[model samples]
Target chain A: MALVDDNLTAAGVAMEGEVSDYLALLKPRVMSLVVFTAAAGLLVAPGPIHPFVAAIAILCIAVGAGASGALNMWYDADIDAIMSRTRNRPIPSGRLDRQTALMFGLVLSVFSVALLGLAANWFAAGLLAFTIFFYAVIYTMWLKRATPQNIVIGGAAGAFPPMVGWAAVTGNISLDSVVLFLIIFLWTPPHFWALALYKQSDYAAAGIPMMPNVAGERSTRNQILVYAILLSLASLLPLATGLTGWVYAVPAIGLGLVFSGLAFKLWRAPAEQMKRNARELFTFSLLYLFALFLALVADVGIARFLEMIS
Target chain B: MTAPTEPEMLSKEDSDKLAKSRRGRSIALALVLGALAIVFYALTIVKMGPGVFNRPL
Candidate 1:
């Protein structure tokens, strides 16, 4: 991982002097979802964490995610340049050098993991370390270029943040945390496959074998529908297991139905209408995830309010 | 280790950019070190409990 200075200099000076380029390397939009879900995990865990400590834990998670993003950009620069959606990324656009990104990611990864261990527990820190490794190496380096199930398996990296957050407070994993993990893990394929359906040509051009590129669109749609049904069931597990109250149960079940319905609609869409269906499913998938996690947080808040009133 | 002093080969603009970058790096390093110090302090306080930093006087 020690990228040589000469190799970086060959890419020439940065095209832009703005710090936003560095921030862009972090994939902040994705990081926001990681932070939000991690916060929900931290909140709904059994024990209390000092607010300051909770802040630090979230910060560490966010930084770890950013580290993963930078490393991914560094490694995927070649394919990124070929894909229109990613061509203007900091590295491929020449706003930042690959070596600089490599160093930035490495330094942040070490700092976040170490700081989390100090602030929380070794288990949480270890989970975070694994997450960074999984995204940067397991997913970006290997699976992305290798198989159609790349996102399916690699989704675990995104799923781990909530578990890490839960562990930060509990110092151990539990069934509840696993449920949270399962929700995101199962949600990943359908969410990404919808985007993949519309962006199939981009992946083909980049030589990346996303599901829509490798599998026929019909097969991919069928698989997505199956995952969507499974995801709906997983989303309701929290309430079924009595981990959360009705505040979460009602919306969780409702969103799950809507999510599955969208998937079914996409599956039934004609070839000419597939892209439009995919875009609709993709848009709703984001809302589906945010709403599910928000329900979890809202349940805790409502319980606290009732406790105070009584 | 200490950072190298002004280099011989860089143009004025490049030198300015290098200086600016060094300054930014230094400030960031200081902030991180400062935050770590506070976190360690907070952890110590938590470990020691309420009265550790307090005095009747």
Candidate 2:
């Protein structure tokens, strides 16, 4: 029976081809956000890292994120192959094989963790390792398929980059780090849910019960509005805690307002108009988070410059 | 850049894709080794004290 199950599994697996297939396993776009957020953590932290070391830390973050993406791809390939939106991904598109993605993820995971440990303190290195585990094992293998609450709980994995970034620089977590963490954590649901709204059938057809597909679109949009309000309120924490200046403040407020407005628009949308609003909100939320973090980096940079000139 | 002369000669172009695939692993190896060398030089040879990780702002 066991051998038969193994044979069945092997037979069920899809074969993929091409070099870009392997590259696609890395989810480069999501890795970019991870790299940027982690870089901001390092840049804004209260200490100095040698330029080269800082770059290495960022590289380690990129690699770890890439590894997580690969692991996610490896596990999700089954469902991903079913979803129209995701069917072109490496494993699903028959460009890269599943076992190859598995090996690639494992190799990159070990290399990233070991190199981060050697390049920086064990504190930062350990956090990176844990992040890989959380995303790959906890979220991907466990929560995502098991629960509609998956993203809400598993969002912590995505939110950890800035904290890892802070640790890379300071080797400790702070209120500011927590604030940054909270911002991303709160932001995740609204960001992902909007996509879920637009991609409901893809998710439903894939047998992944995304909230919009399971609970209904109205409920999903309402949740998006709630998370957006909570996210907007959460954005104010960084400024309130003194981690950001007006550079981050003005734009955060502006961005948060627009984000909330979009959520409101999404909430009030007619059924015909709902998916369009969700798509726009989904796209803009990514930009909103990137801009918020960039603004933080700039504010801190300018503050440091002023301090030096004075 | 320039107003696009896009796809003026699609069929005649060099198959750089072939060379890129053939050379990709070597290029990646070189980058990795070079990075390792820089890390080694920075940490061991130059003897710069561990750079300040973070100082309270």
Best by DockQ: 1
Estimate candidate 2's alpha-carbon lDDT, on a 0 to 1 scale: 0.85
What lDDT would each prediction earn against the true structure? 0.89, 0.85
Off-target runs (Cα >4 Å) in candidate 2 are A1-19, B1-23, B45-57
Best by TM-score: 1
Score residue B27 of candidate 2 by CA lDDT: 70
Chain B structural similarity as TM-score, candidate 2: 0.43
| TM-score (chain B) of candidate 1 | 0.72
Clashing pairs in 2: A16-A94, A16-A95, A17-A94, A17-A95, A46-B55, A47-B54, A47-B55
- Chain A accuracy as TM-score for every candidate: 0.95, 0.93
Tens-place lDDT digits, model 2, residues A31-124: 9999999999899999877777788888998999999999999899899999988888988877567798999899999988887777777899
* Least accurate 10 contiguous residues by lDDT in model 1 chain A: A4-13
Residue A290 in candidate 1, Cα distance off native in Å: 0.7
Residue A59's lDDT within candidate 1 is 94
